[model samples]
Target: MARSRWLPDQHGAWAMLTVPFLAGTFLAPHPGPAHAVLLAAWSAGYVALFHGQQWLRLRLRRASRRPAAARCHVRPGLVFAAVFLVLGIPLAVRHPWLLLAAAACGPFVAVNTLYARVNRERALPNGLAAVVPACGMLPVAGRLGGAGLPWAPAAACLLYFWGTVPYVKTMIRERRSAGYRRASAAYHAVAIVAATLLSPWLALPFAGYLARAVALPGRGVKVPVVGAVEIAGSAALLLTLLLVF
Candidate 1:
């Protein structure tokens, strides 16, 4: 049977969500088997729930003859599930029941994403901005173990929220402005500033790009050059974080 075109693309969403969460998890503290299970369970359940709600909403919208935006919600869920099942199962089994708290938190935040999408009428990008922090926090909480909330996870969430704000605002602004080609540039600027406030080692090079972007008005600067420099600098910083920190 052909799949309905209106069905949500959870796999893609999962893939996108995994990147920052995995990156933060790698940088943050580690977790044991029990915590791992809870994280897996929570992540899995969230994905399932997201798809279920999206399906229900699509049906209702279709029945009302409202135009449906092409769905991308399910994509991330599928991707997250694939990664978690493949990697998380072994760890979960070893720890047995350590991840319950993280599991509990995942659905709470995920429902917020869905509610924002349905009630507030947020677009996919906005929904993602709301969802990503919760996803990122899952592994961090798992690593912390127990139900104890820590300052670092809160800090990480705050940093992510701030980083996403300009990006989201720029996305909205660009819809109305022709001269908004520098949206990514603006995002990099905000990211650099936030990173500086939180972690200078990660922030300085990002700030350098922001400076270049600010200085290079109407210079027709090569985008590839800027992108290459950013990528190289980010790689170097990651290497430093691994080796030195």
Candidate 2:
């Protein structure tokens, strides 16, 4: 009944979860009712995955943490999984081919679960694993809307979301590591170039992304500020993608 146990704890995941879907849905040429169903399915799947990962982490990592904590997730996990299947099956019946995206994301989901079970869910690998599938959703949703994979926009989406992983690491997990700082900066630089090549229009927002990646890491800015900046960056990317493509 408590809210904490009912909701996902990854505050920033809210944006990561939706932007790609919106990007893909909006970019799709033949957007329809199925896309809405897909969104609901996708959301249920994400919440299910989140709780499932947490349950595995608590259940397998140690006995000292208490089984009750793990069990609390079981109900929510099952409920969401059922919801995902309910919303997903009809779309699969209609499209049949969209399952490919779900299948493709499976390995990454496994990686995330593995890291969670090992209590390393916050590690860079786990973060990247999460980013890949989340970004991959762009193409899936685009194709769902009859966009035919929308490669250019999808690549742009991947570029933006991928950089966030290492950038966030530089802010939180690897804040003191100069190596991470360099890596994050380098990634943003590459993202900017890639976005530019994809479309000259995308370069500006990515440049803004690069500036924040470079300037804010060691500045002791609050987490909320970091989150706000990321939110803005995501919004800019989504808007720019919509406008350009």
Candidate 3:
């Protein structure tokens, strides 16, 4: 495949990967080269796995229609994935548990890939799986940075994004349903309140989420604006984590 073909089109997933990695690295009490290498290796492996699985699914679907063309696409993607995997091996070797964490996260990726294959990548399962790899970052950074796993912060991040699932549904698939919009708003509002009760500062992002869920939908917020808002919200969440915990 050409270099462009190796790149993924899913910009949202990229943000999801980057934010947590940075959070884990920066929030770690003492970040060092090991943390950097671990994050790099993990990210490389993640991209390889994602693209490889995508190509496999594409090939399978197209095999009956155009087997030869499918093979051509699969071969290059697999080769690219293999090259990336090889690059990560040396780093993964020194920290075997990092590999274990990746293995654990692999099932979630597989689940996501399967959903994508069936054209259900926006389902509830995808929202849940989106957080798995990110959660794994907590332990990796913690172990390397001498922070010993920042569970509280990790939980906050998890719940914050998890809330996005329902809220986003209201903006897209469930957009016409007042009930779902209400439900999404209610969930976010509750989350904000709960997070605030737990830690006043931690609720800031959720509050922003709540505000958007209530104010944006039915107000003609397009998909691109929605994405921009999400990215901005994620940044706010990352900043909150960096300062609070």
Candidate 4:
């Protein structure tokens, strides 16, 4: 209970948060200290937001409300929030324009906040809303490196992360929903075409993703295997983007 309440259980989020940032920074011709600082701020902000949202989700309930459950999340939430401000402020001061990038997430954050209040955080809409900020970090991090690269990686990140919303739904919450499986497969099919438009190299990873989307439903695939495929898919995207640029 202690560890579980403090950290997020969404395993896929780790990749979603880290990969785009890493890809963006490295893809830049001149990766620098600011990018590292942004990474720290970004990670801390995520941890903080997760804890905060969990507390709110638990607190907003009345019938099943547990004060103890709500209390457990407070310390970590505030601690990480403080750490984020510490890491984020100076960087923001140096680059005032960074505020614009952060502000771009406002609508998504509003969506997430509404869902959290209603205890629907696991819904597909909420999950996809969360992906926007994480993927948005890709371009923002790339910009921090102070060099211009092809926008292909940023576009690839958007397509890959957005597609994960439906694909993962077909594995978990919506696993038994045949409609979800179809939707996931269809999204992957469209993603393959979008990837091809971004770069012919990108189509390879999307094809692999599409193959998994088509083949892996209702076959009792293990949780770890699903995670492994996602990790591999993400790495494949990263590598393919590098090759494309």
**What value of lDDT does candidate 3 attain over all alpha carbons?**
0.74
In model 2, what lDDT does residue 32 have? 84
Candidate 3: stretches off by over 4 Å: 1-4, 66-76
Better of 2 and 3 by lDDT: 2
Ranking according to TM-score, highest score first: 2, 4, 3, 1
Ranking by lDDT: 2, 4, 3, 1
Query: What is the C-alpha lDDT profile of model 4 across 1-245, one tens digit per residue?
Result: 46776678788898999888888888887898888889998888888988887788888794275678777888999988999999999999998988998899889988998898899888888988898888888788778887554467777888999888888778766779999999889998999898898778887888998998888888888889889989998888877776777
RMSD of each: 6.9, 1.3, 2.5, 1.6
Worst 10 residues of 1 by lDDT: 1-10
Best by TM-score: 2
Tell me how candidate 2 scores on lDDT.
Answer: 0.87
Better of 1 and 3 by TM-score: 3
Positional deviation of residue 64's Cα in model 3 after best superposition, in angstroms: 2.7
lDDT of 3 by residue, 1-245 (tens): 46656666666666777777778788877889876666666666666666666666667677688777545546555665676577668767776766777678778887888886775767887878877777667656776676777777777777777777777778877788899889888888788877876579976678778889998878767888888888998899889988887
Q: Which stretches of candidate 4 lie above 4 Å from their native place?
A: 1-3, 62-65
Which candidate do you rate higher for lDDT, 1 or 4?
Answer: 4
Using all chains and alpha carbons, the TM-scores for the candidates as numbered come to: 0.50, 0.96, 0.86, 0.95
Local distance difference test values of all predictions, in order: 0.48, 0.87, 0.74, 0.85
